[model samples]
Target: MDGIHINENLMRRIVRSIDKAIADDIPQYLREHYKETNNAIIQLRGDYINENLRNLVVGGDIEFVPFKRYVWQGRIIVDRAEKITYTITTQKTLRAVPRKQRDKPHFLQTLLYIENGGYEAPVKQMTLMDLFPFEAEALENDYNSIVEGLIDPAEGYRHYVIAYDAEGSELRDVQLEFLDKDFNIIETASLNEYIKPDFARLTDVEPVDEDFNDETDGEAKGLVTIKSGLRPKLRDVQKQA
Candidate 1:
């Protein structure tokens, strides 16, 4: 892999587009569907952003690719020149940003480690390997043979989590995290804090439970659930490097 490279100017443009979606699209959607449950609201918000991000008008050679294959499918923003693919995910946060992964790992989540962090030696793999080895093996076997044709094959991947408050009224934070081969978060950035340096870190936030699971959403702690033969198992089309 060529390694992850961040283009600050392009990142700013992408972040601004997401901000607009949160500020404009979300409120409009909420107004239309006011009686939805909290979990339903989460899905609604995610679907709205996922759909609108494709229509985002961030100029230059950057492109957004939508993968409609698996259950973990979503759109990935790509900077052709930089050869970096940005994976977007949404989460509800007690703090300003998402600090933990799901109780059960998703295939795309696993691919993020392989891309940003490299599928190197065992001692270098992400901490998830030790936490959920059985599920990891299942996910690894389910990886498909398909590949997304790109102008330039991606060298690395970046994760962008759009975290919202529990009430779903506001976007608590938007974070860009860089990971190393050891699965440790090496750096973090947020456009909100970038534009305004004193953007309230929310240190008074409640302590987070690392084993967070939503009974309402029916996400239980077990083997990684995969919708295997239903779709051509695509581990990550963007990780061509």
Candidate 2:
């Protein structure tokens, strides 16, 4: 099949929209949706997945300069400054294909990551079991979590999530740190929770999705009550319920 053309500009727009939409819920959404494919727990979040790939390649990072172009094995490749040549392909590539089935946004991010001088992150082999109930063997077998890290000797890839409250004034980026036997903020997600209860810890007492009440049909659900701030009007004197 002839490869599909992915316009760099259009792809950028779509990625921007995706990152904005997902800046809140995408991490969880990706984990739940793409867990089965490619041995990935959080398939959408790849070390090679560049939400900002276009910029990294073109805009300011002139450090990565393309030196030459060559055609080999039915694909035109771009050779960069460091004596490395990259094949120029589109959605036809294996990494691009599986990701397309998972999520378009994540697919694009992965491609961008690959094109910008990084090894492709093994997102295709991840699963939910690896995320919620990950074991040492499962992690070792899969190529995603640690093996794909930018820096080797990068052991202990723990996703320590910390939550914060946004009190309608300003956004305080409380940098999250993770711990060894001690503590530290390893992986961080920039979340904007501008409402009540900004976040609940995965360890926090799990709230029921639906409030549980043992009472009768009409005796009010979970702590139903009249609003205290409901101000009565002068017209209330004219009539009564």
Candidate 3:
């Protein structure tokens, strides 16, 4: 990907349009890529910002922060009220979780921080809800079979849901919301310490667990749980040179 230096001109045009102060969770890299514009791939970052901005504004809403580029499926969540607007940058803000994997807790924590360390009760009580077909076949002996469905349903079949919580969090405390066919709403179970610069440095994003049946419940443990698939890790990014 070394050949992939971002086009600078696009970044300028795009940056001039977004609300960066409120969208701090958005990576600054977008400002670089948005220096130019592409007509063909409007859904590309350029298009996303423009489209999201256009749609939100048409509905009498406005962007409180600048637009950002997301390497994942889910990115920003906008909430507005009379005379005031704010943006929530969630964990999915990084990119996306691997197939069947999710980035809920991290997203929630990020949202909480962006909202000043406290969120509405509805946002706080949310949890991860899976959309993939649930089956028992893909499960590692049904460790959480009762509350969660199997990874696959048929014998040697798998249809299921798998959720991971922060060290001090729990499954029962979480609330679920049906956002749509493709997306599920996850509310934070509660509030915790706000993330500071030191805590940000402590961000230890881990690698995706390639082995689904590693007898370890598909967790690599200790990762931020939300990461970019298209981008390299800091170490990996530096080593490319």
Candidate 4:
């Protein structure tokens, strides 16, 4: 039941995991396979991220569960120790907005915010329990079993949105948006600085070996050219993973 705060160190780990997936893994997969639809690409990105997070992050209190306990397609992270839960969602824009067009909250996301009183008041498990008064005990047990890492109500509930822009098969930026009771963005933290540089394509470079020794005798050997389908390198080059 501690005050809610953003753990920068933990956030860094999440950012690094995402950076590797979107920048290195996905692009390479696309290069090696046929093109995928936008929806399929989104799912692939989420799977790669969750897999990376499970591997790179170490913690017993962290749990991956579907948002609202039923939306498997919208899986999210629940950190019991931190008393904060967040979901990594995608957006076309660099900034993550709660609403569809920046004016209204998405229906599913709104349900979560409303259930927590939109941060205006502390959430109470009793309030939820009261709804199923006829079968409180049984329902509580079921809910507990379903939500393995429910945030302690006494600690109060805090929700954050981790939004990333991965348009055009490249990650343009990543950010954390803090929201108030009205779903307005109260603050933001950009994690782009922590993202590793983009991977560079090795193209048209001659081999380091100067001599190509062969039984061809005096036959001349021309320079060998290596071809790649990846785009040219930018000024800030990233090491291949």
Candidate 5:
């Protein structure tokens, strides 16, 4: 568990393995484009160590910046008219607590894309886990099979909407309204406005417990108990295993 004891060579090997897996799993269209570029499939690779660890007496604590071992970049021609460049970043970390009492490292990936000349706005981004079934499964299972699970592309799209609606984002003014079965408005809010302190205060004071008649509270209590009581023991058992 000591970060100082981390094997840089092992980490590098793991990164290379994942990179190869990603390259091998790439779609034929993307691979053809990559071949056209004549550039290495993996364009960049680096390690990140926690700088704060230097100031502490316990110097073993370290964190990989970007939270991943390496990053890859390349371009793909979607059609004869347009070419899209993409960056893929990966993370491999030893989790303090692992799922199902399995003490395996966690793997995560992010994908970003932009047109060659379209830099006016930020790059379109999504998690690899949020892609369509074939792509998502390919990326998730590419390496050592440590991925947690797949997330629906719809969820990723919702996340993009929320992020884009934040202050300073292009869609800040976009409002989303939730409706009930009868078409009655259940809630209406803008993402940026919803995060304001005033908005939080207003929403926090709602009589949620009264509205749900203790059912919500009971569910919350159950969740809290599971988190506090079962989670740590599972982690400990995982470590032992």
Candidate 6:
């Protein structure tokens, strides 16, 4: 066995322990308690999973915040005056999750609201492509629609492109422009960025050999050569003087 295997085994044990702890503690709470609710249970499970996994993987002064749903509001401006309000709901803006594991700007759903007598009323509720017929034409013409055909069913959400910070740790406030087939900006919207903490530190783990065999004797065993099988070779070692 190697260090990776050992670490994975340790993680599995820890996860099992945490699961056992949750199971044991759940009975102490009544069914009417909020902890017994489906959302609460899911949140608790996610919290435990992230906390333990981060402790095992990142180590030392690191924290993990699980992903949560958020609604981002922006406005699409047409002709520099005609503006429409849009709202997107997604589970991408993780508070303290790692950049690699964080969700992309996936849209769970989108609502386009048109101003009616100074009050916004939802006019359409769908993807950008479905909401605008011109987007479909643009797609057929090989024009990138900013957000088209990026839906992930497995993700159970919608997707839109959003700017990230330099560190890629958090979303950045920026305007996403909707372009026509001619690559001209037809509309622009200001996207609200979700701020995330910068305390996460990723670390590398060095591998070490793990003994798998239990049988042993007092005398040191000589090298036992094997044929017709693979053997481990030492690489990248400095030659001794």
Best by TM-score: 4
- Candidate with the larger lDDT of 1 and 5: 1
How many residue pairs clash per model? 0, 17, 38, 0, 0, 2
Ranking of all candidate structures by their TM-score, best first: 4, 1, 6, 3, 2, 5
Give per-residue CA lDDT, model 4, range 1-241, as digits (tens).
Answer: 2223666656766777776666566767766775444335535666677777666543555555653333434445666665566767654421223222422234223423433444542332223212322233443444344444444434654666677765444566788766543444556678787665544222211221212221111001111121223334542343332
The residue ranges of model 6 lying beyond 4 angstroms of the native Cα positions read 1-6, 30-39, 51-241
- lDDT winner: 4
Q: After superposition, how far is residue 62 of candidate 5 from its true place, in Å?
A: 23
Candidate 4 clash total?
0
Q: In model 2, where do residues sit more than 4 Å from their true spots?
A: 1-133, 143-149, 154-169, 181-241
| Candidate 1: residue pairs that collide | none
- lDDT per residue as tens, model 5, 122-190: 223332222332243443343222212222222221111001121111112223222221112234333
User: Per-residue error at 207 for model 5, in Å?
Assistant: 22
**Model 2 over residues 25-140: C-alpha lDDT tens digits?**
34334544653443332222222223223232222111121221122012111111122212221112322322233311221122223232122222234533223433334433
lDDT of residue 194 for candidate 1: 31
Candidate 5 to truth, TM: 0.18
TM-score (all chains, Cα) for each model: 0.55, 0.20, 0.21, 0.59, 0.18, 0.21
**Pairs with backbone N, CA or C atoms under 3 Å apart (clashes), candidate 5:** none
Give residue 122's error in model 1 in angstroms: 16
- The all-Cα superposition gives candidate 5 an RMSD in Å to the true structure of 24.7
Stretches of candidate 4 off by over 4 Å are 1-4, 35-39, 67-72, 93-149, 152-154, 199-231, 234-241
Question: Taking the tens digit of each residue's C-alpha lDDT, what string does model 6 give over 1-241?
Answer: 0000112232232333233223322322323354323433423333432343444322222112122234212211111111211111112331111122222322211211101112221233233333233332333322122223322122222112221221111123333333222222334344332121122111122321233112110001111111211111211121221
Cα error, residue 132 of model 5, in Å, equals: 10
